[model samples]
Target: MGIKAFLSEPLARYIVAQQHEWIAASREVQEKWRTGLVQKAMNTQFGKDHFFKDIHSYVDFKSAVPVSDYEDLKGYISKIKEGEENILWPGKPLYFAKTSGTTSGTKYIPISKDSISNHINSARNAILTYIAETGKAQFLDNKLIFLSGSPVLTETGGVLTGRLSGISNHHVPAYLRANQLPSYETNCIEDWETKLDKIIDETIDQPMSLISGIPPWVQMYFDRIIARTGKKIKDVFPEFSLFIYGGVNFEPYRAKLFESIGKPIDSIELYPASEGFFAYQDSQDEEGLLLLLDTGIFYEFIPTENFFDENPKRLSIGEVEIGKNYAMIINNNAGLWGYSLGDTIRFVSTNPYRVLVTGRIKHFISAFGEHVIGEEIEKALRYGMERHPEVEVVEFTVAPMVAPEQGGLPYHEWLVEFATLPNNMEQFVQDVDRRLTELNVYYDDLIKGSILRQLVLKPLRKNSFIDYMRASGKLGGQNKVPRLSNDRKIADELTKINQ
Candidate 1:
């Protein structure tokens, strides 16, 4: 190991030990954070309006602050954007993490001085946890590239504003600065293809050991690298050993990614968002990510089944059970109280409070009462791909075909873009359909009762998703196509692109 790796080993162990202390005292830590956040924001407009002064316990807090999404908080957010002080939190926010929204056009989530550490430290601890467990710190000595949004930021109401990843760029510790790849100038390029080309120019010959990004974009980088050198990724960068990824499930892209690399490698899954860094994969042996309870955030859970209910049952950390899906609600130090994160997660292990991100709360398909989820579809696709090792998928989305243009019973339509087409497409579809039926009982009942026809897979041209995203002006920089939809909006647009 190099000098940095040798030094990090001891530091990594210390960090892991600190993490354990918090994990063991999860409830106490969360309670402390909740009290601190409430007290700090009590004098703010939102806190005063919501009677934060009267809130003393979890029950009081819950009853005082009703659950709120972006729309519900728009009034306060607008005041903050207009240079108001203490509208939501005390004083003005340090920065606003901007993101695209579905119903709302754009969202600006605040990041305060107090809450910024939560984002940075959670990510740092995840890697340190790996190093502590596996005793693998040598990778830190070499080049590490995080394929991310632009480091360039603009100002909004006197606050620096940009994508969360971009804002994080400003905070890379001095120790890692020398080892980080893809020059800042390249990162500042607005166009993704141009930026990627510049990145290839800068790093093609570097001794890179780690690469991090969403899987699809990373796959694109791998494809470009192979095209340039005519060598597998591992062959080009023998030291490249760790992949850090987030924002989507990695299962569907696994086969093609490993095939391109010519070997398997270690990976760390992260659950970072504009609102907070919620969890990170702390153990390679563990099936889910370790939720960061001690972060400057208080978490609540509502069973996903009752999530749509007007008065959903909310549970604190002590009340959450294993293997049940829950819509997460959070009150963070940044002053977002009773905020619905919109992502649904299932607790895979309760001892250390580990969770698997199930899917978006709004991104499921219940058009026919089958109620298929993103996890089920992803697993079923992985199952089919495993059975047919010859097939490689690029991207896919599912939507209900309520009225087939060809005139037939309503069914689910799968728009799939393939990296390599399956030789026996019919068998591939059958395998996927069978697995999905087994995974979702309601879907099986619908098929058996003839209420819905078997799923139909439409093979899309290569780069179909890319074309669609590009056409929508969301070609890169933390933007991605949703995996499934309840409506035909995305599906119809994809069909148009393929046409």
Candidate 2:
């Protein structure tokens, strides 16, 4: 084995051993974090206002702090922006993770010195966990490419501000930094296409062992690799053994991505955000990402059905059950109190507390009383594609078609971009609809009641979604096309772009 691989093995084993301890004591670890975080923030303005000192139990914590979105914390965030100290956490945040908001315009999420470790170390531990479990650490010996936003950052309210990926770039350990590609100069380019081109130029001839990015963007990279060299990625990077991805479901992009690579590679999925690094795939044998209980964050779950209710029941780690969808809430060391993450997840295993990201709370199609979620649609499409091995999906989005221009019944419109169109389009549609019906009984009821027609599949022109994203100036960097929408805003734009 090479020097890098030889050294990483022992460290990997130690990390996994430590992780197992926390995983085994999941509930206790969470309780500890909850109590500790509350104590740490007790002197802060938000803590005083929320009566943090009186939070002796989970019930008290819930009563003291209401579940909050970004808007709810904007006041404190605004103060922090203007150089306020000890407003939320113990003191001023190390940085602000700037993200484009839907209703709030631009949001600045604070990253405390204590909390940044979770973001950086959780990622490291994930790799270590993989190395420990699979006994495959040789990837450390070669080049590793992380397709990410520019590391260039600007200041906001005296704090450095940038996308989470860009902020993460600054924290990458010197050891990995030595093997990381494309060069720092290439990573600083603003335009995604130009940066991607530069990345290709820098790494096309290198000994790449791992590629990490959001799936769609990585797919773009693989496509570019193929186009430039007229060879599959595996041919170009024979040692490439791992693909680490997050931000979107991989199933939809899996087939096309593997086709581009000409072979399959092990992959790790991460549940990370501007708020915190939540979970990471810990084992190759496991079906779900292992939820991080000791990560300076306390987690809560509200049944997805009760998410919009006036007083939804919030359950702690010990109270949650497997297989039920819940909207995730977090109270973290970063000073976010009862923060609603806007994402929904289902626990797949309770023994060690592993979860599958089900969908987003707002990214669902509940039009016509048929609540269809991202997971269902992605699963249904995958089910159909499994039957028709010829079909290769590039990208897809579903939106409610409340009214059809041709005067037919309103239906769910699926705008799909196919890399290779199915020979039997009609059969493929029927299979997808069938799977969706089986997965969502409400949708099946709508179809049976004639309240909605069977979903209409609209084939999109090449790079239709890419064009739409580029037009909106959201071509890359953690931006994801919503899988399901209740309205026609994205649908209409996609149609126009396809035209």
For this target, which candidate reaches the highest lDDT against the unseen true structure? 2
Least accurate 10 contiguous residues by lDDT in model 1: 473-482
Candidate 1 residue spans exceeding 4 A from truth = none
- The per-prediction CA RMSD against the true structure, in angstroms, equals 0.9, 0.8
lDDT of each candidate versus the true structure = 0.92, 0.92
List model 1 lDDT by residue over 1-499, tens digit each.
7998998988998998898899899989989988998899999999999998999999998899999999999899999899999988999999999999999889999999988999988888888899999999999999999999998989888888999999998888889989998889899998888888899999989999999999899998999999999999999999999999999998899989999999889999999999999999999998999999988999999999999998999999999999899999999988898999999999999889999999989999999898899989998999989899988998999999998889878999999999988889999999999999999999999999998888999999988988898788887778888889999999999999888
Residue-level error in angstroms, candidate 1, position 231: 0.8
Model 2 CA lDDT for position 382? 97
TM-score of each: 0.99, 0.99
Clashing pairs in 1: none
**Could you tell me how far off, in angstroms, the CA of residue 85 lies in candidate 1 after the best superposition?**
0.9
